[model samples]
Target: MKLSLGEIADRFDLSLKGDPAIEISNLASIDQAVHGDLVFLFNSSHRKHLTDTKASAVVMREIDCTDCQIPYLISERPRLTWANVAKLFDPLPMQAATRHPSAIVSDQAIIGAGVSMGPHSVISAGAVIGDGSTIGAGSFVGEGSKIGEHCRVFPNVTLYHMVCLGDRVTIHSGAVIGADGFGFEPNKGAFVKIPQIRGVVIGDDVEIGAGTTIDRGALCDTVVEDGVKIDNQVQIGHATRIGGDTIISGCTAIAGSTRIGRNCWIGGAVGIIDNIEITDQVEVTAMSLVTQSITVRGRYSSGTGLMRGRDWKRNIAAFKRLSNLFKRVRKLESERGD
Candidate 1:
């Protein structure tokens, strides 16, 4: 899949600084790039390595091209241009339209045209699978589930009963949607299990990563709005409503009944407490412990930065005595009367 620099520049709308006839076939990092490989310089930290790269073509900002000797593609956003160019050589594999004999599709299920059902895939009674959807091996779509057009349910994925997914939704391998949420009632020292009766509703163009578990609601439907991107191993609790276009990173645990607003970016390993309301456009930094509701739309961080172990212990001790120290300082200030 080699393409000349001229073709790449024309396709990506970038300006070519060197020989446009030079051909590049693959993409690599600046440090490991070889002949016929395409490399890119995006961060200023990698500027020093550009001069020594052996790549046939380099995608870089116009300002960083002074010492670069290779055939270069100049762009305002080099990283974006490099990504678009890389897609030309690395295209997604197209799945063939076929239903394996081992697949168990119920007679009551309505399957659309061009759908591919792999081995051991099960579509339960009253399930509707839309056109061009591919259900991978061992995937199960429970009864009354509605999967929209062009959805891809990867291997071992499970959609429980009554789960509704809109068009172009992609659930990666080992994802479990519509699972029972953690709901219990305290009855005088014994915990009583509360029956989970609601379903999960996922909107269009949502891509859920591998091993992510989205719990079903206790009484109301758990909703994930359009264009929401959830990373791997995330735990989305029951009755939660995630607004449109929100991006949640890996290992994030969102508690039940929480309402997360639109376009919010939740970083990795963030723990959001139950029943909390986070407004739109909020950014939660990685490893943050969100213990309270965030009504304002702003970036919030709670995790402490890395430090020497001894220094961290000292800082923690100091932080604990801050109230007493503040009182002493106030008394000293009163005596000085300055």
Candidate 2:
């Protein structure tokens, strides 16, 4: 998949500032690029590494050409152009409508045209697989579930019964969708389990990462709106409604019955408790615990920032004295009034 510098420039409509005959077999980072590799420079902070890069060519703005002695393509958005070019070098394999003999497809299931079911995959009874969808090896599509067009259920993924997925949804390996939510009632000094009868509804273009689990609700369905990107190891509890275009990072845990608004950015390892409403465009910082409802639209963070050990100890001491200090100020004000 090697491409000449001139060909790339002409394809992307970028200004060519170097030898047209130069070729690159692969794309790489600026620091790790070797001979015959393409690199990119977007931030000025990375300009220091440009001189040391051994790439055959680089992609950068025209102004950066002054410091770069190597052949480069001048682009308005170097990263976007580089990403498009990288796809050319490493294209994904196409999956056709061929069902592997090892796959188990139920006669009762309705599979559409151009669907690819891989080896050892199971399409349960009464399930509907839309056209151009790919069920990867060892995956399980449960009974009565509906998978929409062009969806990709990656290897070993499990979509439980009654789960619904929209078009172009990508579920990665080890993801468990429509599992039972954790529900119990204290009855006669013992915990009684509640039945989870709800399904999971995933909208179009939603990409769920590996090992993520989206639980089924106790009564209502768990709804994830379109264009949501969920990262690896995320745990979403039952009855949660995720708005469109929300990006959730890795290892985040959201409790049950929570409503996450549109275009939210939830950082890695963040914990959100149950029954809280997060407004639109809210950005939660990494590792923060959300204990209450976020009514306004803005960035939010909790816990203390990184500090030296001595400074942390001093802060802890001051926190302990805050209540006493408040009382003392109140007493002083009362004496002044007297």
Candidate 3:
């Protein structure tokens, strides 16, 4: 989709400093942009490329356009404006309401208008797929599942029994929703399995990334609230409640029964243990381990910063001798006492 500079400015409420007639066909990074491409300046490090950018028009904050030779659009939030523009040019295909020849949908299932099913996709008995939803190739919708309107379940995705998805939800490839939680009872030197009966209820506008797994609850529903964006390979355990608008980055593992509050930012590879509560607007940095509850709303981080290998080894050696050093200091203090 081609958009003129004036239309973008009007749509996004950005102040137009460029020629309104200039056509923008695509988006690119400032350093890599070519002719007919729209570039954005958000980071200070990328400001060096502003004068040399080959794009037709640039999007940047008003303060950064002083040295810009080319036409530009002024935005208070440049990155957000860039995202909105990118959405206008997104090239994802829209499938019609047709089932592939290899697709197997049960007669007992209720399929809504404008729904499409790809090859080898299966919709089990009592499954309800809402209007304009797409089930991609090799995907599975298990018994009693309900998918809301305009949801996209990408190829190889699995919706286990009784799973519920809200409107405009997007589950990428290989996402496994409503799988059984890890529960066992130990008796007589052996373990017995505990059945996971409850479902997973995902709220509206949630985007779950590829290869993510959300386990079904043992006692109640595993709930992911509205507008939560989960990055790839995240593992959310059973009965965990992720509050609305929380952003969890890649490789984060949230243990069972944890209650994460609204608008929290959980960084990549962060480990959150079970049964803990994190309050609203909390931010946990990457690689941090959350072992206890967070009641306050602020940024929290753990683990040491990266250093040279030799320096780390020296710190480790000093850490090992701390107890011995403390004992010697105590002895010296006792001898000095009159």
Candidate 4:
């Protein structure tokens, strides 16, 4: 996809400082771009490359436009403008409706127009696939499940019984939604399984990454509200209700019955204990362990930061002296008796 610098500037409403006739054929980094390619310099640290870059045009802020001979599209938000320009090149694929002969679709299933069911995919009895939705190769749509219009369920995804996906939802490969929740009781020295009776309800425009697992609820549905972005290899436990626009990063494990409020940011590798209620706009840093409910909106973190091995050992030793120090301080205060 080729776009002229003038066209891009006019469309994005950015001020142009270079020749308007220059054609941009591709996008590249400031260091990697050659002539006819578009590049970006959003960080001040990379400003050194401004004069040396071979890019035909650069997307940059007005301040960085100094001492540069090349043409540039000045944007207050260069990164955001660069994203818009990139979309002009790499647009989403619009595939025609296709259903392979190898697909196994039940007669009772309802499939709308412009649907694509790939080879060996299964549409169970009473399943409803909305228009313009694509079920990838070998994916399984469970009985009575509903997939909304324009939803994309990639290969090997398993949507268990009665799961509901809203419009524009994207589920990546190997994601298992509506799986059984980890619920059991210790009865007579044996663990008895509690029934996972409810399904998963995902809202519109939500994107679930690969290898993620969202468990089915015990009684009520496990609800993921609209515009939530979930990263790869994440496991969300059953009965968890995630509010709108929350971002969950990779390798995070949220325990069962947790209620996460809107716009929260959960970092990678974080471990949250079950039955917790985290309020809106809370941000948890990477690798932290959350043990209780977070009621206030703020950045929360646990786990020690990285340090030298000797320093870490010394810090651990110092913690052991805290109890003794408290006792001595208490005795001294009692003797003073003010």
Clashes of each: 0, 0, 0, 0
CA RMSD for every model?
A: 2.3, 2.2, 1.5, 1.8
Better of 1 and 4 by TM-score: 4
lDDT of 4 by residue, 213-245 (tens): 999999889999999999999999999999999
lDDT of each: 0.94, 0.94, 0.95, 0.94
Q: Superpose all Cα atoms of candidate 3 onto the true structure and report the RMSD in Å to 1 decimal.
A: 1.5
- Score every model by TM-score: 0.92, 0.92, 0.97, 0.94
The RMSD (Cα, Å) of candidate 4 is 1.8
lDDT (C-alpha) at residue 235 in model 3: 99
In TM-score terms, candidate 4 sits at 0.94
Alpha carbon lDDT of residue 31, candidate 4? 85
lDDT of 2 by residue, 239-291 (tens): 99999999999999999999999999999999999999999999999999999
Off by over 4 Å in 1: 319-338
Q: Any idea how many clashes model 4 has?
A: 0
Q: How many backbone clashes does candidate 2 have?
A: 0
* Candidate no. 1 TM-score: 0.92
